[model samples]
Target: MEYTEGVVKDKETVIHVHPNDYEKAGNSYLMAIVAVIAGMPLPIINLIASGVYYLGNLKASYFVRWHCIQAILAQTIIIPFNSIAWGWTLSVMLNKTEPTLYYGIYLFAVILLNIIEFVAVINTASRVNKGENVRWIIIAPLTDKLCSKKNKSPYPLY
Candidate 1:
């Protein structure tokens, strides 16, 4: 496996991922998914769960930490869009806001984006669990920037 920019061409980890670490990293993505389902009423809960996973895995190996950050970033991207939709939904239900063509269009867009994100998360989590380092199109660059080799993790990976 060729390592370049913290990514494995096929498979590898700079810090030598433990068998379980792979699962942990993959699970970081899944947590957000679980929260997404359970917290449909409050979309922010998914982000919160992913954030907590990131914090808990702060000391984990680079591979694990990288995946955690990616998961959180994914949630971060959808939160605002989801929030707007949720708020609009609440407003409509409470009869505080009138539904309109614009609202329907916007809600449809948000739901489409959310479904795409959901599929991406599931695919990424599955790959990570199988010991593959998946790089998300947008989230990867940001994660690499935030969790850099320059700022080495304080705790041991093993």
Candidate 2:
């Protein structure tokens, strides 16, 4: 095990993790990506992944649990947003309306959001695999709050 400064260690709490287990912990993110892609054209897969992470890993270490909770929380937000976007697109299609400027902007925004999230998760997972703490700006506080409130699990060597 090693102690590494978190992404915002100066201001945020630092987490200690084991090198071998960091990548294991980050598997939650990979699962999230898989769910998102597999459930594409339908927005429910995010919920499935989120549920699996939150319910299936209650006994995971604090380090793994933290990342899992963050991934779940992010999926919670993204799933609904995607559902709404798809619904909007469907409504437009049903009404036979010409794609408007707003639609273009919305499409661009969704694409941008997806790209940003993909990059962030990949970067965070890679960093965490190296036994470094990584934080997501929007979800970090929530992750901390939830993980702190839960029973803290000891870091495992494996």
Candidate 3:
């Protein structure tokens, strides 16, 4: 584990980070993006890749674990929405199902959501690479819950 403590300057968090660890933490987000593209049809691939990365870094510092968990959580959130869109797309293409107005609306909503997530991912990755931590709205709190608070503990209860 490699890390040093720093105040996030926001009440939302107190970051435990190491400059040396930033690259790996940052790369995790990029990894998620790559996984998503590589498995475009399978929304689960990004989540699975994040899980594997998290597992591999079980003994990593708190910063790395936090980012990994955060990235994974984001992937989890995207999966169901992406899966639904993908399924509907296939159904429309193969089954010749009529596209309802609701379908168009849903697709638009999903695309917006995906774009938001994508921008957030890129921003987080870039910031982390620069030794800056970005705590997301919902995912940060969730990640903190899953990741240990103590500097010496990488994963909680492990």
- Highest TM-score model number: 1
Please say which candidate is ahead in TM-score: 1 or 2. 1
> Between prediction 2 and prediction 3, which has the larger TM-score?
3
Any runs in candidate 1 off by more than 4 Å, and if so which? Answer: 1-15, 150-158
TM-score of 2: 0.78
- Candidates' C-alpha lDDT: 0.82, 0.71, 0.81
* Clash list (residue pairs), candidate 1: none
Provide the global lDDT of candidate 3 against the true structure.
Answer: 0.81
How well is each residue in 1-158 modelled by candidate 1, as lDDT tens digits?
A: 52232334423334555667789999999998899778888988999999888888777777778888888888888999999999998999899989999999999999999899999889989998888888988778888888855424464443
Clashes of 2: 0
RMSD of 1: 4.3
TM-score of each: 0.85, 0.78, 0.83
Kindly provide the TM-score of model 3 when superposed on the true structure, using C-alpha atoms: 0.83
Residue 49's lDDT within candidate 2 is: 80
C-alpha lDDT (0 to 100) for residue 117 of candidate 1? 90
Off by over 4 Å in 3: 1-16, 150-158
